[model samples]
Target chain A: MITTIIIYTLLAGCLIASWVMSREKTIKASKMALKVLVKTMPSLLAVLGLVGLTLGILSPQTISSLIGTEAGPLGTIIAAVLGAITLIPSLVAFPLAGSLLRAGASVMTISAFVTTLVMVGVVTAPMEIAYLGRRFTLLRNLLSFAAAFLIALLMGVIL
Target chain B: MKTIKRYLPIIIIGLAFIALAIWDPEKADASLTVSRDYLKEMILIIPPVFLLMGLLEVWIPKDKIRSWLGAGSGVKGALISVLLGTLPTGPLYIAFPMAASLLGKGAKVSNMILFLGAWAALKIPQLVVEMKFLGPEFTAVRFTLTLIVLVIIGQIMERAFTGRHEVLWEQPGESVGQKTKQMGTKR
Candidate 1:
């Protein structure tokens, strides 16, 4: 809701200002936007479907069951993999993590879930590759996956 | 045929959805519901995003962009990138095109990493929600650790990519990325 408002408000502001400045350029910008919209459509649709499938199969309930079902290193690894693969909206994910915490998920496991859940995105890689390309996506994600574990491990040790 | 190849992913997903609907209608319904909601998001957000990027391309001067986010911009650029990332409330995928645009416009690769990392992990609104669910202490510790690690990752990535030459920022397309990959192998 807030994102919608912020983005549209910015868009309206930019559009009006640009119109006042140069109608031709604003039209040109709109054309550019349309071209990009067309270009980005296929991958965007692909990602949407992929996200649905991933979340559908690995629903939050299923995820909680898989993760934190055990505790210790095994649990952490399970949580990490689930987190890396799944693309839960943060709104859904945080509440789920909190409940898992209450329901016997260890600090280590929950932190790992949250960290990798945010940092590493296996599902969205195709859309990312569409814009940023394959190698950059692979490198960034691999590095982030490693960083998430380190961050999770430290968080586990500390709090 | 090319169109079929291009739409193969969607075609495969359509099949999967159909299979799920036949096997378990409820799961298929849930999946579609998720996709529908995100479709709403895509419809609402992507237009403004495209318009904004176009305007940004037209309105912002190249030199100004360079000075603000270029190789020599240093800590200021990184800070700006993080700030840019945190202010927006959206999925991580939304950051990809914006990051690509900035990279094409002379932004440092390391800084784009920071922008993306912050957008993904350190979003302010996300943190607030995280604190409500997780504890403040947990959020704080993870925030600090993630930020620090992202900067380190950014530094390492920039060095790894930029080591070869000015291959990355000179061109602004995925083909260049493939070239970088090929170059990395030759080295």
Candidate 2:
């Protein structure tokens, strides 16, 4: 409810701002904005759909079972690697990670996954390349994946 | 041919999702329902985001951002990038395009990497959720540890990769938004 309210308020502000700004040259600005909106909508919709489905299908318990185990060193490594590969949006990943933490998933695994989920995106490669250049995007992701693994390993060792 | 090349991967991914849905209709339906719930939130969320992004694009000078965030930048700059990223609300999708735009304008690879890392690793909203669901200690520990890792990784990337050489920025006249504009103009 709060989030919704915040979003609505922001939307109202944006509408007002756009309206005021558009008054200077209403038709041209409106047309340009609409044009940009139409082009990006499909890709944006597709990404949102994928994120939604992934969240829907994977239960906290299931996610926990797969990578949340405290199977000593091996489990931590698996968790880290899996975390690197999987991409979860922030809105869902944190709550889910918190749930897994409650359900006995190691803090290390949850941390690693959350880190990698944001840092590395194996799935969004195409969209990323389209927006960010391919070489920069790919290298950054690869480095992030490695860093997630290292963090998990260190967390496993320390915590 | 260009269109096919551009959309091929998305098409493949979509087909894969369809296949998964067909393979288990029950699971697919459940997923779709959950996705719809999230989508509703996203729709509500996205419009303001679009406007904010537009405003930022207009207001923030790219050169100033680049000097601080550009390749081979200082530790202070990298830290600043990370801090800015950690404070932001919303998902990586919102960040991705913005980061890409910055990259086009001369944002450093290390800064972008740090931005992506910190954005996902340390979200204030997610932190609140973590504190509520888990505990303060756990959230604090995780945040600190992730911050440490992101910084260390940023340093490593700086060392290993020559950011100067990498094609970090977008080429002239090739923005995703620009492409869309051209398409619209044509129509």
Could you say which candidate leads in TM-score?
1
Error at A122, model 2, angstroms: 3.1
| Worst-scoring 10-residue span by lDDT in model 2 chain B | B163-172
DockQ of each: 0.62, 0.43
Error of 1 at B168 (Å): 13
* Among all candidates shown, the one with the greatest lDDT: 1
Cα deviation at B70, candidate 1, in Å, is: 1.2
For B10-120, candidate 2 gives per-residue lDDT tens digits of 676567568778897777776677667767866776555555555445445766776777654687778888887877676676677667656545666568777877777
Q: What is the C-alpha local distance difference test score of each model?
A: 0.84, 0.63
Model 1 has a clash total of 0
Question: Residues A19-125, candidate 1, lDDT per residue (tens digit)?
Answer: 99999889877887777678768889988998888898889989988985788899998998999999998889999999999998888899889999999998888
